[model samples]
Target: MGESPHAVTSLPTARQAGCPFDPPAELIEARRHGPISGFTHPGGKPGWLITGYDLVRSVLADPRFSSRKELMNVVDFELPPAPPGEFLLMDEPQHGRYRKPLVGKFTARRMRLLTERIEQITTDCLDAMEQAGPPADLVTAFAKPVPAIIICELLGVPYEERGSFQAQIETFLNGETGEEELMAAYTATQQYLAHLVAAKRAHPTDDLLSDLTNSDLTAEELQGIALILLSAGFDTTANTLALGTFALLQNPTQLAALRADPALTDRAVEELLRYLSVAKSFMRTALEDVELGGRTIEAGTTVVLSYNTANRDPERFTDPHVLDLRRQDGGHLAFGHGVHQCLGQQLARIELRVALPALLNRFPTLRLAVPAAEVDLRPEIADIHGVKSLPVAWDA
Candidate 1:
């Protein structure tokens, strides 16, 4: 409980009860202690946690820091290299080899071109919700499907298999399932993708994964890429939609501002991303001893980049806790930073820009069906924090 800047403790700190939107109180306090603080990884290894905006961003951009899984010093045992084509965890040429080929595929213009299609998808979801009537679990009914369908379709996941695919992904990524279940789901997903990649190689389609099959990427590499896209493509955006709506509903003034002017849609999405920061934290290991935040991170030391706290840094944003949809300050680390920044960011932006406003417009009376405190939240241990089932209702 000491406020010393060098405080070290086990992470991740729990979010206070009834305060789901804020970072864990301990994390915020740790940020107050200093941008960076000594910590112990869950495996009992010495580590550091980065919570300040500038420090987090700088570390993300620093090449001396390694994103490689094999290099992480969090555990005594050596971790295997990330599966083939899992570029996010690799450094340099290996990362570039996988990432560069796909950069042009998700360009701003390409994502922008998908707006009409995204709008159509959003409208379809609203139509389904309207048909189903009020008091629905928005996670299952709306949030999950919007991104699920888009990503599934984009990845060329067979229509007949999407339900299973979605369920498997939810099982593994939600972080609630047991270790055995998680590994089973993960193995199943990898097996399925391997088959899908082979199928695409023989019978290619217009989707992104199918397109990648034509390149020199091996089947294993293609499968890894598919896993990355499918997981990242849906999980983050789905949670953002559900959690952002919760934040807006909680702050009626911000809700009113967004509903009153559709032009605020873009800013609202960005602001919500900054405020909620559902992806929480990521780990990076130092390749060599490096000075950061006035502390020396020794070689192989893994640091937790606390995105939720960094996005809420007081020095970075005025009134950091307030959810101002019109917030002008723009350099938030919600989608991360540097070479490892989210590749699907443009697509996510377009989806949020379309989905949130449409949902608000469709149900003008939208509000939490149960008391906000009763809403079930995914555990802090979940890779992405969000509501488990947001039971929302409007005028019947």
Candidate 2:
């Protein structure tokens, strides 16, 4: 293996001031230097940071690089294994065990079958926005509720509780909440899911979680699985819709292309997913020594895969920084790659393909209600990056 590159000690938190959609300049620079670089986790344990597109994708597909949470050696203290069904943090056959049963649930065909319902939900949101008049905070009015409602239905969560459940999720993910608030929200969600799981066991319904009850999975495992699905399903797509709209409004030419040709919708959705890549970085640990990008990842070492940078890597994309709806390039890591790739990706695609155009078509004059700079953004430390509230307006 080649000599390791010097470590970039800190993970970047600041995006270039005006470029909210871009990865931090430091990360882009790191990718330019080399695919793999040395790093020190905030906890002071040494690790690798993989920023290049090819390298990130390669590492994600490598079984020698484990995803087990307990195996992550980033900190000195021992960390517990991921909860029972949180398989994203586990390696196979555990990961495969959890993921395989649910594959049919999120198949492209299954998600596509929900297109009409997604249309109705999108329409309902636009109707509410129209009724409420102009200058609405799109985050609350449209983005958050659309996906929140869908995930709740999928999980068999009671309709009436969705509002509070959504709030709790936001509190945990928005990245600015105090520790007490964060813990409160997390505890509430866990308690709610526990009760929800028992309820599903007692009385199965037509929903995905209800269906999973037939599996040998224990209630605790079901709760963990629900938590993963709920968090990933709602948060990622919600931010993509909100932030994608922001990007569209900023680039009117691209927006016009999407609006003018419904045929562009699918391609546009992929581009937006790639461009936003909001669920930024993911960490993996080497189960044994592995050579990647000409450097050795020692056994039990953690590596941070920078998704946003990978999506924007100039080597893999032409004019990587620009968002073009008609651009033909695909295979972005927005939903990730390999076995751990997002299961809900097809569902997310349907949401965007249905929601964005419906939104744009409903309000032709849509534009930001506040100055671009004044739009509140989630803190850089947030697990997901996006606007806190997108204040948007259209002709009354």
User: CA lDDT of 162 in candidate 1?
Assistant: 96
* Residue 261, candidate 1: C-alpha displacement in angstroms: 0.7
Positional deviation of residue 303's Cα in model 2 after best superposition, in angstroms: 0.5
Per-residue lDDT over 1-396 for candidate 2, one digit per residue giving the tens place of the 0 to 100 score: 235554678775688878989998888878788888888887888888899999999999988888999988878898999999999999999998889889999999999899888989989998999999998999999999899999999999898899898899888988899999999999999999999999999999999999999999999999999999999999999999999999999999999988899998999999999999999999999888998888888888999999999999899999999998988878899988999999999999999888999999999999999888888888889989999999988899
TM-score of 2: 0.98
Model 1 alpha-carbon miss at residue 205, Å: 1.0
Residue pairs with colliding backbones in model 1 are none
Query: What's the lDDT for residue 20 in model 1?
Result: 90
Q: What C-alpha root-mean-square deviation, in Å, does candidate 2 show against the real structure?
A: 1.2
Clashing pairs in 2: none
Candidate 1: regions farther than 4 A off: 1-4
